[model samples]
Target chain A: MTEVATFLFSAIRVSTPLVYAAIAAVITQQAGLLNMAVESMMLSAALAGVMISGATQSALLGVLGGVFFAVLIAMVIWYSAFIMKCDLYLVSISMNAGLVGGTVFVMYLATKQKANTIGYIMSKTVGKLDIPILKDIPFFGEILSGQNIMTYVAVIAVAVTWFLIYKTKLGLRIRSVGENPSAAESVGINPVKLYGISFALSGVMAGLGGVYMSMGLMSYFARDMVAGRGMIGVSAMNVANASPAGSALFAMLFGVSDTIANYMQIIGIQPQLIAAFPYAATIVLMAILAYVQHRRYQKYLAKKLSQSGFEI
Target chain B: MNKVRKIESIFELARIILALAIAYGLSLLCLILVTEDPLEAVYMFAIGPFTSMRRFGQVVVKFIPYALCGVGMCFMYASNRFSMFGEGAYLMSGCFVAVVAFLLEPFNLPLLVMLPILLIVGGFFGGLIGFTPAALGAKLKLNELVTSTMLNYVCLYFSLWILKVYLADPDITFFASRLLPDNVRLPQILDRSTIHAGLFIAPIFIVIAVIIFFRTRLGFSIRICGSNRDFAKFSGINYYKSIIWAHTIGGVLVGIGACVDLLGIYDRYLWNEITNYGFYGLVSAVLARKNPIFAPLGAFLLAYMHTGASILNYTSEVPIEFVQIMQALLILLISAQTFLRKTKNKLIFKDSQDAIMKEGKTA
Candidate 1:
């Protein structure tokens, strides 16, 4: 029972960054943009979080700086995609690559280190929260309480994203612009402006996720530490069809797989094989999703053909 | 019509040059901002690659892998699939080349026989890895971008596993595969540099790519599908087959490129991290506008910039990562269809107006 609870606890801890990434993905995906630069955003933010917190010795300022940097990168991508009319995918891919290099450069400039900011900076970390009354409960409380504060924020982020996406008037405009930009433009909603807003919102989410990685998850920012989490978040968002709650659930699925892999490493599995497990699982999940979506599409096509009086 | 075409082509060329200049200028600005000795850093970055024969050879060495992968990417990009499996394919294929060399060492095959087998085996496995994401995308309608990116990591970890389990030299403290026999490694061709027989082998694949792109029916269909999927479907082209074949062909080239790089560059399989040649190749492909013919030119330009960046890294305080940022800026500026769209439109419009006025007078 304790083992299961412990596993669930770590799963939530691991899922926090992914949850934010999924939320970020959900926002952009709904705005009819496939933003792969969530990786870039998270990475920049993670570094910024470490740098700011280390410099100023304030975690709050660090959090803000992290989000700001992410949003700034998002705006750069937005300018390229919307203003300059570059291919979004190409822009994002380049941005991802550039930022990976840029972060190392910046880290090198500040800390004179290439690997991580472990010894050079005394970075302040975000505090974990132990929920009152909930901490008293047996298995469930042990799983839920005393997680990194970012984990709670991730939960709130999902709810806020759901509200922003489905319930608000801005949500309607975003969806309208995404669905048919020409129609939205005819109705006086600028798709380009909505795209900026979407990018900004996603940046904010990615920023929080990055902050969790550096300040909350680990004490210092490590080079390429976000690794494939941002991409995994993308995969999660893809699997969930861009629904906020669903994306979070899928993100949790990755967290579970990752946790299992980490455990498997301790149990004498090859480290490389263990490291490969989560990604392999992600591919399998994607394949399944693709198959299901294809089947659905075929069915829809068949129904449409029949309705149009075409021969079966 | 000819004048309009010439004007448009001139505009396209101008846009590319302007993009290149801006990226270079911005990268210089970054160096000036960060470095105490701005002039020294900028000088090295701009003129360093051409300073000596050895440096130029380094550019050529880098150029081989970049051009091979760039040409490979032309096929994938032409298919409009946005598949990024090339990075993984390159890394894994390179690893496999080493693995194959090690496995065949006991057989005592000659260089002529052994080299071809290694290249073929590497290409086959690379093609197999490339086939996965493309086939998935073609048949099941998966997003090739996501699947391919995921597969890249999977390939990385799998390669690491292979390196650890079977091939890692026990003597080396840091993890690396066993060294290949001297006969297995490609012979160096350049006098004062690391340029290998891969230089000769790279052109063969480039010629093959050129033939496939310009001379083949399959290439025509792939191009048609890329440009207009609905048109291709209406014209009865097998869309799935074209997508799969394009990616597989790309995968084959990427694999061969990996083998070339592995044999040409190193004595042992030293890559523990992603080599990033595949990603850099995408930049080359995009710079060439996805034309296989222009891939070598694009690759050469990038190789030069990369060599300069490394030069800057060693000679000054600036890091080699500066090139990556410049590459990103280059991709953005060059690929932006609207960057000089107005000027292009104006030139074409003026040419059309002139033609119309002349036609009116003739009539």
Candidate 2:
């Protein structure tokens, strides 16, 4: 029972960054853009967060700087895609490659250390929350207590995203523009401006995810530390059909897989095999998800045909 | 009509020049911001490759793998599929070739007989890995991008395990295979420079790719399937067959390129991670607009910039990563169709109007 509680707690902790990235992905994907630049934004923000926090000795300033940098890059992406009319995927690939190199260069320039890590900087890492009365509850307390503040923010972000996407007027405009840009234009909505704003919101969410990686999870920044979480977030958003609650659920599933992999490593499993588990799990899960969706669509089509009295 | 054609060609040339100019301008700004002596850094970046034959040879050395992979990428891009399995294909092919070469070291076989066997085996394994995502996409309705990306990590971990268990050299602490035999190594083409016979293979393959792309019925089928799938299907082209064949051939080309790079550059398989040549090749393919004939030129340009950056890194305190930023900027500018669309339209419009007025006078 204790092990299960510990596992659930760790899964929530691991899912926090992924939850943030998925929110970012959901926003852009809803705006009719496939933004693979999430990884680049998160990585750049991770480095920026660490550097700023180290210099200013304040986590709040670091978070602001990180979000600002990510939003700046997101705007550049918007200009490149909308105004310049570049292929979005190609722009994303280039930005990812550039950030991979740029982060290392900037890290070296700032700290005079190797490009791999900034472990010596003693940055302000985010503190964990310990709710007073909640901490005394039996099983629930064990599962919920001692998580980073970002984890709570991630949960709140899901609710906020849900409200913004389903309940607000801007959400309607964004969805209409995504569904059909021409039709939206007929209604006097500027698809380009909405897309730019959506991209900026995605940047903000990805920035928070990046900060979680450096400040909430680890105390220092490392090269390519976000790894493939951004991509996994993309897959989660797809599986969820761009719904915030569904994205959070899928993110938690991945987080569980990650925790299982880590546990296997601790129990003396081969490190290489353990490393492959999360990716293999993702592939299998994605295949299953695709199959289920296909079956559902087929069933729905058949039901509609039957109701309309069409021949077999 | 002829005058309009000439103007269109000139506009295309001008667009490329403008993109290059912007990329270089941004790079200059970066240097000025980062370095103490920005002018010297810029000079070294622009002119250093020509200062020595060795540096020029470095450009040629980098060009071979990039051009080969670029040509390979043209096949997949032509089919309009964004599969990223090429990175895994390259890495695994190198791993297979190293294993083959290690086993063949004691046979004392002739180099002519041995090299072809290694290339075929290496390419076969790479194609097999590449076939997975294609087959999955066909059979299960999966996204090739996600599947291919996942497969890359899977292959990386699998290869690392193989190296640790079967191929590790106990003498070395790092995860690397044993040194390959002399007979299996590529012969040098130049005395002072590290230019190898493998460099010649890239151009030959490029020529072959160009011929196949331009002259073959299969190539036409592939292009049709990419541009208009419904039309291709209506015209009785087998979409699945064309797509599978394109990806398989692309995988073989990249695999061969990986083998060449491993044999020509190093004595042993020393890579613990992905070499990223496949990504560079993808960039080259994009730069060439998925045209096989232009891929070599694009690869050469990228390699030249990389060589110049390395020279700058050696001479000044500036980092070599600036080249990556410059390359990204170049790709962004070049791929932007609307960058100077107004200017291009005006030029073509003027030419067409001139042609119309000439016809009116003649009549």
Candidate 3:
């Protein structure tokens, strides 16, 4: 039971960054943007957090710095895609490619190490929060009480994302823009402004995920440390059809598989094979989701046709 | 209509040149920030590739893969399907070709017999991988970009697993497959360089791609579907078939690229990462404006810059990763619809005015 509790704790801990990334993806997806550059945002943010924390010796400043860099990248992407009139998808792809190299370039300039900032700099870690009453419980407390502060923020982020999407006027405008941009413009809402807002919000969420990665989870920035987590989150958002709650659930599912892969590596499974599981599983789940969605659409079409008295 | 097209192509060329200049300026800025002698680094980066025959040969060798994948990407982009399957296709096909060569080595086949078979296997395997995301996108409406990227990771690890399980070179310390047989390795064409027979092979594939893209009905259908979907639909074009064929044919070219690249460059199967050849290919295709005939020009520019970056790597403190950032900038600026929108509009406007006056005089 204790071992199971430990596993659950690690799984939730692992899912924290993913949850943040899913929220980021969900926001842009809701705005009808692909936002594949979420990966790049998180990456640059991770490196920024490390550099700032190491330089300033303040984790809070590091978090703020990281968020700032992520938002700046978001604005750059917005400028190129919107102001410069570049293809949004192509811009996102270029941002992903550019920012990774940009981060590495910055990191090498700062630390003179091309690989990581493990020993070259002294950086503060984000504090872990232990709940008071919840800490008294046995297995459940162990799973729920003590986690990185970012984990708690991630939980709140999901709730806030739900509330912001469903209960706010801005949310209504964003949705209207996504549904039909020309219609939204006819009604006096600028889709471009909403896209910029969505990009900023997503940048903040991705920034938090990156901060958690370097300052909370690992205590230092490693080159390409975010790995495929950003993409995994994007896939989660896709599987959930851009719903905040559903995205979190899918993220947790990936988290569980990721935890299992880690343990499998310890049990003598080839690391390469074990590492492939999450990506392979994501593809399978996405395929299944697509199939189910397709069927639902077909059923809806059939129902509408039958109601209109049209023959099959 | 012809005058407009001619004007548009001219503007397109101008956009590419301007994009290249800005990207180079950004790279130079990065070099200035890093190096003690900025001018020397800049000089080496800009002009070093042309200074030495060996370095120029390196550019030619690198150009082979980039041009091959770039031509392939033209087909994919022509159909408006932005699938990233080319990356996975090349890696998987390269591994498959390596494995097949290992199997075929026992027959003592000559180079004439062995090379074509390996190329066929590679191209076929890549097409199979390519068909997956195409089908998923066409039939299931999954995002080909995301699925194809995920599949690249799968292919990378799967290929590595295959190497470890079936063909690990016990002699080598790294997790690489055994070296290919002597007869299967591509013969060097240059006197004192790594430039191989692939220098000829890449152009052949490029020519074939050009013919397929410009001279074929299927290519026409793909272009029509991409440029105007409703028109294609009303015209009774098969959208799904065009999408699938575009990706599959692109996959075949990418697979051939992988085969040729492996044969030209490596003695053993040792790829451990998703070589950004596919992404670069997509960038090349974009630079070409999805025209297969111009894809080589894009490929050559990228190869020259890459070779220059490597030269900087050897002589200066600057890392070659900056080239990626520059390449990204190049793609963004080149593809920006509004980069020089006013200038293009003005040129077209002037040309139309001139044409109208000429028509009036003729009448």
Candidate 4:
């Protein structure tokens, strides 16, 4: 039970960034856009959040800086895809390329440092918030209490995103635009506008996620640090079919697989192999899904062909 | 009409040059940010590759496989699939050929004939790498990029697994396979140049790719499919077949890259990860706009920059991230509308819903 408790808590913390990016990915995908820049956004935000707070000696300033740069990169992505007519996903790649480089470039500019920086930004980490009368509670406290403020934000963000996606007018437009753009266009909806806004919002979500990760987790920004979370978000997005709640759940599952890596490895395989847990899991899951879908599609095609009595 | 054509041509050239300039500028920014001796380090990073004949030769040798991968990818991307499976294919090809050379020590076969045979086998199997996602895309309707990327890991890991299980020399310290027999090696060209038989192999196949691409009905069908599948259907082209063929030819090129890198330099089968040769090759393809013949120059330029970065590494505390940043710059520049064609948008994207559905299904 103690082991289980420790594993779950660590899993939630590690899984937080994936959740943030996955949430961001879901919102963007909802608007018919595939943004690959989430990784870049997170990296820049982590740095900015860390740097600002480090400079100001204020965690709030660090948070603001992180959010600021992430949004800026998001805007750049929006401009390229929306106005430039570049493929949104590819543009995301371009933005990712630019953002990471941009952050690195700025790091050199500000600190005259090469790749990595010294200390967490503001030299301040996100402090844990102890809920009143909760520490003495058993499982509930173990799971929920003694967590950072960002944990609550992630929880609230997940809830709000679910609410917005299912119960809001903007959600309908986003879904409509994504599903059938031509149809949406006929109904006086701007597919590009919806996508642009959604992508920007996705960037912001990713930004917030990055900020929380930096201050709340490591309390410092490192270069090339986002690693594979962006790709993980891509995995989570696919697994959940862009459903916010589903994505968050999958992200946690992914985090658990990752958390296991920190512990003992099965057989002789190192934690590095298991570090690819989310990707490997998604690949297996996807293959099965594809086979089923293929069967279903073939059946439908066969039924339609048979009814027509003529092969077109 | 001629004047208008001239202006458009001028603008296109301008864009290409501007993009290159920006790519360099970004690297210069890295130089500035490292806050080093701006002029000295930047100059070394840019012009350091040409400081001497040996350096030039080293640059050429590096450019050799890069060109091989580039021209190979040119054929594949020209066929309109944005697949980077060549990375795994090239690495595996090199590894396998290394293994084969170790076992086959027969003196009966002539050097020329034996080398071609190995090259052909390597190319054939290497081409097999291209078959997966191309097939998956056609048959399963999956997004080729995601499928190809995953397949890369599968191929890389599977190769490592094979190496660990079958090929491990028990006494050796590092994770590497057995050394190759001397009889299977390519005669080095100039003493200085890394130039091997594979460098010549690239051009030979590139010519074939060009002739096949422009002169044959099959090639025409590929171009048609890339332009419009619906139109290709009316013109009697097989989209699936064309994709497969393109990837197959691409595989051959990539395989040659592996074989050359293996047989020419290192005589052992060992690679911990897929080399960036495939990515560089893809960059050459993008820069060349899928034109097979134009790939060498682009490949050389990218290689030269890599060498320059190597030079930079010697002089400073700057990380390899600088080179990767250059890669990002190259991708951005190459994928831009004018640097290549406006075709990047068409080839690189799928319908969002379709892509999500396909990638999701595969994921």
Candidate that scores best on TM-score: 3
Q: What is candidate 3's TM-score for chain A?
A: 0.98
- lDDT-better candidate, 2 vs 4: 2
Q: Write the per-residue lDDT of candidate 2 for residues A1-312, one digit (tens) a residue.
A: 999999999989998889998899999888887778888889988988898998999999998898888898899888998999987777887887788788878887886554555566778988899989998999989989889998988989889988998899999888888899999999899999999989999999999999989899988888778887887887788778788899988988888888988998899877877787777777888788888888898899999999999956
Tens-place lDDT per residue, model 3, A1-312, is: 998999999999999888988999999888888788888989988998988989999999999999999999899999889999987778877777777777888888887888899898798889999999999898789999989998999999999999998899998887788788899999899899999999999999999999999999999888788887888898899889999999999999999999999999999999889889999999999999899888999999999999999979
Candidate number with the higher TM-score (3 or 4): 3
**Model 4: reference contacts kept, as a fraction:** 0.10
Ranking by lDDT: 1, 3, 2, 4
Residues B79-109, model 2: lDDT tens digits: 8866777888988888889888888888889
Q: Write the per-residue lDDT of candidate 4 for residues A1-312, one digit (tens) a residue.
A: 877887788888888888988898888888776666788889888888878887888887778778888888888777656665445555554455456656775676566665567642345677788888986799877877788888778878888888877799888888898889999999999987887778777877888888877788776566667865766776677677788888888888888877776675654574435444555566666566677888998889989998989675
Q: What TM-score quantifies how close candidate 3 is to the native fold?
A: 0.97
Interface RMSD of 2: 1.6
lDDT per residue as tens, model 1, B224-293: 9999999999999999899899999999998999898888888889788877887888999988988999
* Model 4 DockQ (Cα-based): 0.17
Which residue pairs show backbone clashes in model 2?
none
What lDDT would candidate 1 get against the real structure? Answer: 0.90
Evaluate fnat for each of the predicted models and list the values in order. Answer: 0.84, 0.67, 0.76, 0.10
Write candidate 1's Cα lDDT for A1-312 as tens digits: 999999999999998999999999999999888879999999999999999988899999999999999999999999989899888888988998888898998998898888899989898999999999999999889999999988998999999999998999999998888788999999899899999999999999999999999999999989888998999999999888899999999999999989999998899989898898888889898888878888899899999999999977
Q: Which candidate number maximizes DockQ?
A: 1
Q: Which lDDT values do the candidates have, in the order given?
A: 0.90, 0.84, 0.89, 0.74
| Lowest summed lDDT window (length 10), candidate 3 chain B | B78-87
List ranges where model 4 is wrong by over 4 Å: A94-122, A129-137, A144-148, A217-219, A260-267, A270-278, A298-312, B1-10, B29-36, B98-126, B155-181, B267-270, B317-320, B338-363
